[model samples]
Target: MFNLVVEMNTQKIRKDFPVLEKGIIYMDSACVSLKPQQVVKAMNCYYNEFPACAGRSMHKLGEKVTEEVSKARKIIAKFFNAKPNEIVFTKNTTESINLVANSLGLKKGDKVITTDKEHNSNLLPWQNLAKRGIIHEIIKSNEDNTFNMDKFKEKIKGAKLVSMVHTSNLDGVTIPAEEIIKIAHEHGALVLLDAAQSVPHKEINVKKLDVDFLACSGHKMLGPSGTGILYGKYHLLEKLEPFLIGGDTVIDTTYTTAEFEKPPEKFEAGLQNYAGIIGLAEAARYLMKIGRKNISKHETELNKKITNELLKIDGIKIIGPEDPELRSGIISFNYKDADPHEIALLLDSSADIMVRSGAHCVHSWFNAHNLKGSARVSLYIYNTEEECDKLIEEINKIVEL
Candidate 1:
């Protein structure tokens, strides 16, 4: 159903993001998205109009802040087709996954399976569990970077949990999340999806995916930084223990013993990011208005257009899957005898193009494959065909020189 490619009004959509008018071609949405004016204004209203703590003070401003926070939670919950209480606020995707890893109560010799394509956020959490006597098993992809479902099926046996990245930042490879989730459930293993890369660009229904836990960041999806969400089924959340304690996380506490709050409140500790959360709600609303399916189609078309032109260069090499249809909005490439960092600098200085280079926080994957990093170009709803043409024109100029 998601494979359908529809057209988007790029010129009209571009007006929503103020940064696009600066003549800078931003292709780094995978790192962090450009926030729309609506999102920024939402945050400003939180600080300027109602500058009060939620659920703490009894003043009118505090009451308004509490209502806004509750409304924001419902908005985010509806965005992912999840219950409001199932959503837990976090610092970012890194903290969200760590919360799951530490709270899962892994025991000595319990097996946890993951893939080689995972970003450091998903990979490091499971690896850290090894110090606690948990066994971390990694499933390697094929030489062509395609997932080997047979290998995944073989390793999922007797596994306590299966964690995977829904979409890859390294190469824009989108995994078969539904198929993977089905296999993990059959083996009686809990599944967690790192949706930081996928959720921003496409639609993800947690109940439909049937994932035990899912993590994504607000900053990567057009909200403010230092805000994220961890969605867990109520039953699973009740079974897992809370990693952080004290403050509002507990309903009551004594010096000797404490009674923690339920589900989300139990996971969330200390003062929350009120402004960022409100901004994130506005961001979700903005994306919802645009339609996730349409955004996906627009990004895929842009990636294909740029990739087709890049392939015509003699020394150019595309990373990850060969087909543009199989990838997300990200496209990574490297040239013969040219350093990726130098090429990126040239693009930034010469054309004011913004792109990311180097390991992209997947250093272990690059080291395992015995290769250097590549330059990456990621797109979003605000990007345009003219920007793509300019990027290609500059790259071709480099090749000729």
Candidate 2:
């Protein structure tokens, strides 16, 4: 009886995220996930037991706290199948990308390939580089929101760097990453993956994938905000310039000149978000224990059930990959005559279903695809089938209005 069935262990899981205390269904994990008890406790441990700065201290308390941060780096590196030296802590995904973008030795006439599907976080750095005479080419996504791989390859010829959003935030379209990375490597183009959405839902093997650079935010994955990761090959990071000066990033400084520390330290400037990052480590551990495969399966089922039922309502249009397996937890759609914001308001007021309805920081994608806006329902491992039923019920009422 159990052979063909796999049920997520949500009872134990829901207890971790205390925000369920709201007495409402929270379904917007794609935007920012609710924190678990362990994550909260980790933050508490820092403040209660040993609250001190990381990486530049002689006192026992400071050294111990710093070691925890260092241990977190090792855990993150092992998770990605990389060495500890490859990861750098940043404020969020945007800051992570900027660390690399500003550090690059890019100049006039250098080429970068990206897509219209990218959020502003992934798109703006290259656009800014374009103003300095660096070339930025927008690879168009097909009508169904899938990337055109053949066209992407054709565009990669002679490009110095290629960067794309790993999973689109607007439509939840997962690009064929293995193909993209392989082709980019063949073309001598460095690939950077904006994996803000993918990290929380999918199994990532940076070693097996051989992706040069990757960025993700902790908040999007059941962790704290003001926290994120930037990963790069050690050699590439060593070659890039420093993003900021002063403080620990510098090895030595005088009135006239300064020398910077190696790769990871060089990128992290000033005092950082210690507590948020500590919570991020705890969140990653929680996800690993539960298993990413199980998480993906649970969310895919929810997306399928919600997508099919929502589409049955008259005048509704579902966006992104029709195949639930092609994406993860996000479901973005719109009603023909109904505004997305209005729809969201009704759902929240009447059904207590929490979701996000807006451009979701991907305005370029919407304008490129000729869409107004969309209502998005993103699920996490803690979400249940009963919540899906309630959402479907509320959507039906909204359409009838």
Task: Highest lDDT: give the candidate number.
Answer: 1
RMSD of 2: 1.7
Worst 10 residues of 2 by lDDT: 1-10
lDDT of 1 by residue, 79-105 (tens): 999999999989999999999999999
Q: Which portions of model 1 show Cα errors greater than 4 Å?
A: 1-7
TM-score of each prediction? 0.97, 0.97
Alpha carbon lDDT of each predicted model = 0.89, 0.85
lDDT value, residue 378 of candidate 1:
93
Instruction: For candidate 2, give the lDDT.
Output: 0.85
TM-score of 2: 0.97
Give candidate 1's error at residue 240 in angstroms.
1.7
Poorest lDDT segment (10 consecutive residues) of candidate 1:
1-10
Question: How well does candidate 1 score on lDDT at residue 318?
Answer: 82
Checking candidate 1 for backbone clashes, the offending pairs are none
